[model samples]
Target: MRLIKAARALAGASQDELAQEAGVSRQIVIRVEAADETVTVDAVEKVRAALERRSVVFIPSTAERGPGVALSKTG
Candidate 1:
């Protein structure tokens, strides 16, 4: 998803770094970011969690705006 790439960029992390953080392979991150339908929900969730752990907050899309990411202000 766009948010994944954005989050990674915001975190200043490489795919390898994110994969290590998520406990998944770099290929998994690539697949998920590519929006490959075959990628499992679990893999996607792991990637999301990894980003969250780095303070990347995922904002859900609303009628007025599309989904987005933000860095958390908290510790």
Candidate 2:
């Protein structure tokens, strides 16, 4: 949830923009960022895909660090 919020913020994307990009509803994006348990995995994946398309690279959490996102160099 935190990662998604950060990605959108850094990408300068509004919820409506993300929703359009993900082919989901703005409410779904809202629920996702809020960490709502009812948000489906499919919806989350769609949002992730959309972020990736916008050059948001998701980083895995290692023992010494937390999960985070970075911008792709090509973007």
Best-performing candidate as measured by TM-score: 2
User: What lDDT does the true structure give each of the candidates?
Assistant: 0.93, 0.95
lDDT of 1 by residue, 1-75 (tens): 877999999888999999999999999999988889999999999999999999999999999999999899993
Which clashing pairs does model 1 show? Answer: none
lDDT assessment of candidate 1? 0.93
User: In candidate 2, what are the lDDT values of residues 31-61, reduced to their tens digit?
Assistant: 9999999999999999999999999999999
The prediction achieving the highest lDDT against the true structure is 2
lDDT of 1 at 34: 88
Q: Model 2: clashing residue pairs? A: none
Model 1 ranges off by over 4 Å: none
Q: What are the TM-scores, per candidate, against the unseen true structure?
A: 0.96, 0.97
